[model samples]
Target: MNRNYLLNDAIISPLGFTTSENLTSIRNSETALKLHRNSRYFKEGYYAGLIDLDWINSKFSRIGNPGKYTKLEKLIILAIKQVIDPSQNFSTRSSGLVLSTTKGNIDLLNNNDFSADRIYLWKMAQVIADFFELKQKPVVVSNACISGALAIKTANDFIESGRFKNAVVAGGDLVSDFVLSGFQSFQAISSKPCRPFSNDREGVSLGEAAAAIFIDQEQSAVGESVHYIDAVTANDANHISGPSRTGEGLYQSISRLFNNSGVDPSKVDYISAHGTATNFNDEMESISFNRAELNYVPVNSFKGYYGHTLGASALLETILTKKCLLNNELLASHNFTESGVSVNLNIIREHKRKELRTALKTASGFGGCNLAMLLQKQSL
Candidate 1:
């Protein structure tokens, strides 16, 4: 099987528009989550990570007509554009596009200005595919919060199977009234910025972001290269909204990943967890990590910095993990002060330097779905 190498990437979020900018903000301990008093999202104010519409529109105007696209579409387009090289002649037949999102254009359900067809997930994918002139049909992944990681996994499978030479995987979600109300109804919206793994941690702080990366057999020339070893997904079928109490699904996923890849668990130097900060989710992950004997590894969650970005969480977090490996640094789990879960974990609470090489990026979502992807720094 041909090894998939992660090449160029981009991130458009509340923190910044580019991956470098977002990393700088994280290094400075800056968070995009804020207390929004907007009644449009909820009856009571809630905290979330939201990008400024004006800012994104201004940036999109330089490349394409912002009016022709939805907010999420524009974000994905801008992100994918950054990863694509204008000088390289992309083979339309061999290239693939994978889009990850839980709810694409969900906010447009009641809007009359756009046709109903525009609200379909496939339509959203088509818009992005057309923007890049990708001739092949795009694949869409929407498995709750695990969608982003699963999308990347799908692309990796395609490349490994010799189905495609390369693929562009992009994911994004919006912080809208529809999404906010859903969380609010579950009483999972935090009153303030989230504190992942902290004793005082509340619920999740929703966030919106778009992230994209190019993956192929060839290493990238412009940035630090990383090898996409393998990814595994498991479902415990525990509940509709809650994770497995014993972390069965997550543990299985991690175990399978290491077993198949022939990599020891101890080889994993860092963990970018799907730390939503919700009590059940965080606790389940803690137990899972302990079960997998990853308790001693340094781990951190980007939720405090970007909130739970739903479909974009896994992809966005994975990109940041690549950045951490390249810079040989461990970013502090923002807003984390004390350990909250039952099992002890080496949750990174302070920004520090370390010689990172291998990383395990984990994501668990509703319906007991869990995924773990292994990434290693390529010794260029």
Candidate 2:
């Protein structure tokens, strides 16, 4: 079925409230991350993509039960408001809600007052649906790091399946004691900003953010419009917790997206990579880029600007990638030098100039999940 599918609306995070402001930040390579000294554990002062929650609360004061919500809820609501204001969309009939996260409400466990198993993945869905009072059933996707991209995939499916007239898909996660302690356990925390695919690359900096996208088949012709050309999810069954060192899963995901979308790899102008700056992730991405023969396509990572957002990472990165496609601009990879992988691909070290008609956003998750999305500029 050649169903009607599109990514017409969005509510992004860690950059700015509006598309223009975020795009400007990307062009200037200005980062939203800052070293925080909060006593929430993990006090080595990691760079975080800080959100102005105070501004959000004051701006959307009329939202329901605002005081009862947690920081995660507040972030979700803020992004929700960007797409469907309670004053409008809430009063309507049932709408679809897809919330993605790896570890929902992990901040609650910091005080030793809460437990981990209590955080069932499905609870994330209920929390958001109740907030808007839309009478809609919410779907939650908890695929570790690939959660965000999977949320987008689910939204696209529902829209194409005629399950709802439209949908609100939000991705959110926080950098709390739980995540920081775990990353530190794995020895994945970097003292300074990360450098992806570089010989001097260290581990990733963990951060938190919430982003929402309103995808619908209806063309309003009034709002800012962009398309999610095609997306796919693939798993490396060989490894339960780690990626295929050969980049097999990543390569398969991109190959599938291209084959499904009928888009050529050589035609892809830019790659919004999941360059986490980890030794393994960068190498895998480079291997995949080489196999796909997309080395000429300039590449960059938002991790330098917005740590590894975990569940919300891919969605946030895709929003930035779409911005580049809309503007035909290429961003730098922040800290990078010396090829770690055997590939001739141009790993963009500085903001490069280019015309992007098509761009690909790729992500990999724990539990062997990998995903890719192909996007194209709309011909006006």
Candidate 3:
């Protein structure tokens, strides 16, 4: 089997458009989440990190026609365009596209003139694939918020199985009336920016983001000291909208990841957890981490900075984690003051220097879906 490495990546978020810009903002502890009093989704004001459509249009117009692209489509195309180098030559026939999102063009249905045909996830995948001129048929993964991480895992499978030499995994989602109303109905929308693992945390702040990663087997295509170690997924099917009370799926996934790879949980220098700031989600993760003996590891959630970007959260967080590893710095888990969950966790409170050789990324979405991935810094 061929080895997989995260070759290149780009992120289009409210913090910034490029990866470096976003990293700089993260290092400074700056958050893009803001209170929106005039949101189109709710009558009451909500907090979220929304992308400026005008900025996206202006940036996209320079490369492609803006009049023809939807909001999500533009974001995906721009993110993908940023990571791919014009000088690098690769056979399109052996490279494919994997699009990840929970809802694709579902917001399009909110408009009266929107075509129903555009709401199909496959159609959205095709549009992105055709734009990049990928030879293989595109793959779409929409398994809740775990979609992004699953996309990366699926891409690695394709490459290792000799089905493809490279894969561009892109994940994106927008906060719209459809999504906001659903979450609001569930009382999951926080009135302010989310404070994951905080004792007085309310709920989640919806955010929008688009991120893409280029994964290939060629070590030379990627730089030194960064490669995917493992990706494991599990599901407990405990509920459609809630996590398992025992954290069964997450614990099992993490345990399997370490066991299969023969890596110890204590070896992980940092953990990017799926801390949504919701009552069940945070508590569930606390149980899972402790159950897996990862309680002593330094952990943090980016929800307070970016809010919950749905399907894009994992991919976006993974990209930022890669930056953290490269810089030997750990990002502060913003807005966390006191431990809210039942278990004790070494939550990061400040940006500190550390030698990070291995990192674990975990996410638990609706339907009890859990995913764990291991990233290792390699030596050239």
Candidate 4:
């Protein structure tokens, strides 16, 4: 199998506009979630991490023309433009684009100002590909919350299969009245900042963000890049809205990830979990980790810092995980006050330093979908 490496990346979130800015804010234990009493998304005030559209427009106009792109499209283009360097001689024919999102322009459907005819996922993808001038047909993945992680895996597969030398993977989802009301109807939106694995946890806090990551089969210009060792995705089909009680899908995904990489469980330094703070989701993760014998590993959830982020969570979290490996530190599982699940986990409570060699990222989403990926620091 060909080795795949993360070349460069960028993030556009409420924490900060750049990757470095977001990392700094997270390290400081700052959260982007805020109380929006007048939000049109829900009847009462809802806490969410939202990007200022006015700010987005100001920054976007400096880079390219506006009105031609939707808010989501502008976000994707902005993120990709930040990390992509024009000096690099990679060919458009050999490079591809992959986008991940759960609800692409679903908000446009209810808007009388915008035509619903332009709301198709493929049409949105074509706009992005044309903006970046990628020659290859764009790939779009919308598999619940695992969409972002699966997008990276898709890019890795394409590069490893000799189909493309490089791929630009961008994932994002904007919070809107449509999505918020849907979660609200399910009673899954937390009233406060979500506390993953905490006894008093309520539910998930939705967030909006756009992030782009570049992957290539060739050596990275950036020194000592993280390598994509392997990834596996599984489905339990327990329910359309809930995960399997036994965590069967997640267990199988993690098992296959290690089996494919031949990496010992003891070597995994940290776990970036899909801790949505909801009762069932967090409990399901505890069960999955224990079954994999990974309970001893230090774990943390980024949801407390960025809210759920929906489709952007996995990709955004992966970029932050790479930063954690680089810094050799484990960030705390923010807002966790006590153990709430049956299975015990070594959830990090404070930022601590450690030599991280290997890490695992996992996410389980609606539709009983699960994804696990192994990342290793490039040996110097």
> Under the 3 Å rule for N, CA and C atoms, how many clashes does model 4 have?
0
What lDDT would candidate 4 get against the real structure? Answer: 0.89
How many residue pairs collide in each prediction?
0, 0, 0, 0
Residue-pair clash count for candidate 3: 0
lDDT for 35 in candidate 4 is: 85
Where model 2 places Cα greater than 4 Å from the true spot, the runs are 1-14, 39-44, 52-66, 86-91, 110-118, 222-225
Instruction: Give candidate 4 misplaced runs (Cα > 4 Å).
Output: 40-43, 86-89, 112-115
lDDT of 1: 0.90
TM-score of each: 0.97, 0.89, 0.97, 0.97
Q: Candidate 3 clashing pairs?
A: none
Among all windows of 10 consecutive residues in model 3, the one with the lowest summed lDDT is 83-92
Q: Write the per-residue lDDT of candidate 3 for residues 286-364, one digit (tens) a residue.
A: 9999999999899999988899999899999988888788878899998998999999999999999999989999999
Q: What is the C-alpha lDDT profile of model 4 across 222-299, one tens digit per residue?
A: 567688888999998688789998999999999998898899888999999999999999999999999999999999
Better of 2 and 4 by TM-score: 4
- Residue-level lDDT of model 2, residues 1-380, one tens digit each, is 22333343344456766545666776777776677777355567676666666765664576654556666777877787677752233223656888888887877764443345435656656766776776767888889888888888887787678776677878888887777778878888777777677778778887767787666665445544467777888898768756788899889999988898888888888888998888888888888888888877788878887788899888878777767776667888776677666575687877766777788899997888899988766653
